[model samples]
Target: MEQLFTLAGIAIGSSGLSAIVVAILNHHWAKKKNSSGKLDALVEAQKVLMIDRVRYLGSSYIHDGEIALEDKENLAEMYQAYKALGGNGHLSTVMAEVERLPVAEKR
Candidate 1:
């Protein structure tokens, strides 16, 4: 009877430990998932901001009918980043237009 009680105690202890481990793993997974979601949101927001800046710069250059070499370089960098962040082809068209513009001479 004593051995039976010992075995029961061990079984109970093992079950409790298993439950605790499962709980900890679940909590860790939930935290990681939440962090991933936040990161995705941040990336999407950054992509939008990049798109806006690219459009603004591209439009400015296109409207002016010329882009300074420095401005063109900067715009190219911005457009590259925007494209890296999954920006659409519409901006590609705008960038092409900007690319065709004459380079302005520095005063």
Candidate 2:
């Protein structure tokens, strides 16, 4: 009877320890997942902002019918970054149009 009680006690302790370990691991994973989701959201926001900037600048330059060399260089850098962030082909068309615009001579 004493041996049976000892075995039961050991089983209960082991199960309790297991439950605590599982709880800790679950908390850690949940925190990690939340952080990963936040990072993804931030990256998506950045991509959207970059796309908007590229579209605005490209459209403005196209409408003006000319772009300054310095401005064109800046636009090119922006476009490159946009592409790096997985921008689609729509901007590619706009960028091509911008490239065709005449460069304005500096005063």
Candidate 3:
């Protein structure tokens, strides 16, 4: 009877050990999946913002050259585009021209 009880205890202990190991593995797998999804989202957002900054910087340069600042609606459109695209990049010191632009003409 004593031997039977000892064998049962060993079996239970091994099962518990396996359960703990499996739980740890599952936790690591979940974290890896979540981080992968976040990384993909960040990359996509960066791509969009890069495009916007490049486009705005080009248009702003042209407008600055072709006469006095005409209508700021163009600049406003650019600012919002910048915000959507991620807004991190900036143009050359020349692009300081963006601030000179107003929200819109008084109409």
Candidate 4:
């Protein structure tokens, strides 16, 4: 009975230690997954915003015509937001295309 109790105590101690380790690992993984999810969301939002900006400008806006001052402001604001969200410096294709659109000079 004494040996059995000793064995049981050892078993319980090991399990408790293992449980703490498992909990720590779980927390780390959860934090990593959450950060990944947030980054993915930010990228998606930036893509959508870029697409919308292009659509708003149209081909004419791309060629000879200039984008409205408001459009330019919105694009800058969105790009800032994207950067804040940890976007890479490499511009998205849509973003590059939109950047070529001339902003109307303030008179």
TM-scores for all predictions: 0.90, 0.83, 0.46, 0.51
Can you give the lDDT of residue 17 in candidate 4? 96
* Candidate 2 lDDT by residue in tens digits, 1-107: 99999999999999999999999999999999999999989878888888788889989989999999999999899888877877667588888999999999789
Worst 10 residues of 1 by lDDT: 82-91
> Candidate 4's residue-wise lDDT over 32-59, tens digit each?
9999999998778876675565445454
CA error at residue 70 for candidate 1, angstroms:
0.8
lDDT per residue as tens, model 3, 12-105: 9999999999999999999999999999798677767655665566575556553234444454465556556565545433245555544442
Query: What is the model-wide C-alpha lDDT for candidate 2?
Result: 0.90
For model 1, how does the per-residue alpha-carbon lDDT over 2-106 read when each residue is reduced to its tens digit? 999999999999999999999999999999999999998998899888888888889988999999999999989988887787767758888899889999999
Off by over 4 Å in 4: 62-107
Error of 2 at 31 (Å): 1.4
Question: By summed lDDT, which 10 consecutive residues of candidate 2 come out lowest?
Answer: 81-90
How many steric overlaps are in each model, in order? Answer: 0, 0, 1, 0
Q: What's the CA RMSD for each of the models? A: 1.4, 1.9, 5.6, 5.1
Better of 2 and 3 by TM-score: 2
> How well does candidate 2 match the true structure in TM-score terms?
0.83
